[model samples]
Target: MQEQEVQRGVLALLQRIAPELEPAQLDGRVALREQVDLDSMDFLRFLISIHEQYAIDIPEADYEKLVSLDDIVAYLRARLPTS
Candidate 1:
C-alpha cells in the first residue's frame, strides 16, 4: 500500500478507537497516546484494528515502534502486501 493509504488507515483506526480524536489536527511526529485519550487497552485495540485491516502480524515486542502516526505509516507500508 501507498504511504498515504497506510496513514489514512491508521487514522481511521485511531478514530474508531478514540472517537474524540481529531485526525486533521494530529501531529504525525508526536506519540499517539499523548495526542489522544488512548489507554493501554485502547492502544491495543488500535493495533489489533491495524492487524485486522492489513492482515499484518504485530507482535507485542514491536508495539514500541508504533508510537507515532509517522511510525505506524512507515511500519505498515513496509509490511503491507503489494498488489
Candidate 2:
C-alpha cells in the first residue's frame, strides 16, 4: 500500500480505539498513548486492529516502539512486503 493509504488505515483504526482524536490532529508525531490515554487493553486492541487491517503480526513486545505515527509508519514500512 502507499504511505498515505497505510497512514489513513492506521489513523482510522486509532479513531476506532480512541474516538477523541480528530483527523486533523493526526500530525504523525503525537505520542499515541499520551495523546489517546491508551492503556494495556487499548494497546492490545490497537495492535489487533492494525494486524487485521494490514495482515501483519506485531508481537506484543514490540508495541512500545510504536509511540508515534512516524514510528509506526517506519516500522510498518519495514515489515510490509516490498512492492
Candidate 3:
C-alpha cells in the first residue's frame, strides 16, 4: 500500500471512531487523541479498525508508536504489503 492510501485508511477509521473529526483541521504531527479527544476505548477501537482494515496485527506493545497521523501512516506503510 502507498502512503496516501495508508493515510486515507487511517483518516477513515478515525472518522468512524470519532465522527466529529474534521480531517482538514487535523494536524498530522499532533497526537490523534488530543486532536479528536478520543478516550482510551475509542483509541483502542481505532487501532482495532486499522488492524481489521489492513489485515495486520498491531501488538499492544507497539500502540504507543501510533500517536499521530504521521506515525500511523509510517507504521502502516512499513507493515502493509506492496502491490
Model 3 stretches astray by more than 4 angstroms:
none
TM-score of each: 0.94, 0.85, 0.95
lDDT of 3 by residue, 1-83 (tens): 88887888789989998888889999999988888888999999888998899898999999999989999999988887788
RMSD to truth, every model: 0.9, 1.5, 0.8
Candidate achieving the largest TM-score: 3
Spell out the clash pairs found in candidate 2: none
Residue-level lDDT of model 2, residues 25-76, one tens digit each, is 6567878777677898998898898889888888878978999987898888
State the lDDT at 63 in candidate 3: 92
Winner by lDDT between candidate 2 and candidate 1:
1
> Would you list the clashing residue pairs of candidate 3?
none
Candidates' lDDT values, in order?
0.88, 0.83, 0.89
Q: Total clashing residue pairs per candidate?
A: 0, 0, 0
**lDDT comparing candidate 1 with the true structure:** 0.88
Name the top lDDT candidate.
3
